[model samples]
Target: MFAVIKTGGKQYKVAKDDVIVIEKLEGEAGEAVSFDSVLMVGEGAETKAGVPFVEGASVAAEVVEQTRGDKILIFKKKRRKNHRRTNGHRQDLTVVKITDILTDGKKAAAKAKKAAPKKEAADGDAEAAPKEAKAEKPKAAKKAPAKKAAAKKATAKKAPAKKAAAKKKED
Candidate 1:
């Protein structure tokens, strides 16, 4: 079975036990890397394509080695200007062996791993909030009654002042 995977802004056609050279991946040798973006998969005479990317399709590969790729010599020259420059570069790469092609893919694994810890954290917060609310309720109730008593006293004083002003006007 052969599959085409896209990684690092490039695409590679790969199969099990087939060695391929590609742009650098960040890792040491003998590490495992799984490519989640699978564009196409073919086996024997059958081929399946992805709409943008195949849903639930993945390729798991083992990083067999990591090394520098072929050196590219960049030369710039201008006639009659005595300007010539040359530079060489080598790109880092990781050699990986295709291990497995999962048609149902990596989304399930990633989603499960991503959600488990979040759910646990949310439950922990939920359990702690009720205790804090219980501790705060009595203090809130005491403040509410104090505010009501202050408002009643202010109204009582204003009513007597209005009555005194009315008697003065009549005299």
Candidate 2:
């Protein structure tokens, strides 16, 4: 099943197992996140859409990681005004894996658990699950802050030629 949901002033059409990056949400990795503002839900030919938001419909996801988007620079210049400014920004983001789409007010946890079998199925042991989650945490923690020390040189301004012109006139 697929559903369209809204978050961070944006809309996303998502399905089970889809990994998506979105505006930062306050939660650690592995935390469950649910989007309640569902615009539409559908399976094949059967579709239901909300006038504003579909009643009793939601999308459930698990936070895969917290991340930052690529750095973007914003530069402004005023021609002939000796004014220029350069700034850089990086947006905070969260990577999430959609686990379930629910309709008719179904609680997400029930279905999400059903989607991924817990323990002993894949790893064949309960201890391995926590170890994997622990191992992944350090990787996310190693993010270096975006480098802001290197500002682009503003070399557009040129030395005035008025003095040179006057010297030539005197000669």
- Candidates in order have lDDT scores of 0.80, 0.85
How does candidate 2 fare on TM-score? 0.65
lDDT digits (tens) for residues 1-171 of candidate 1: 888899889999988877777788876565667888899988999999998788888887766787898899999999999999999999988887777788865432221333457659778799776887898999999999999999999888764444434444553
Pairs with backbone N, CA or C atoms under 3 Å apart (clashes), candidate 1: none
Error of 2 at 27 (Å): 0.5
* Candidate 2 weakest ten by summed lDDT: 144-153
Which model scores highest in TM-score? 2
Query: What does candidate 2's lDDT look like per residue over 1-171, in tens digits?
Result: 899999999999999999999999988777788899999999999999999999999898998899999999999999999999999999999999998999999987633333256533756776777888899997766643222222323333566667744444553
**Cα deviation of 132, candidate 1, in Å:** 56
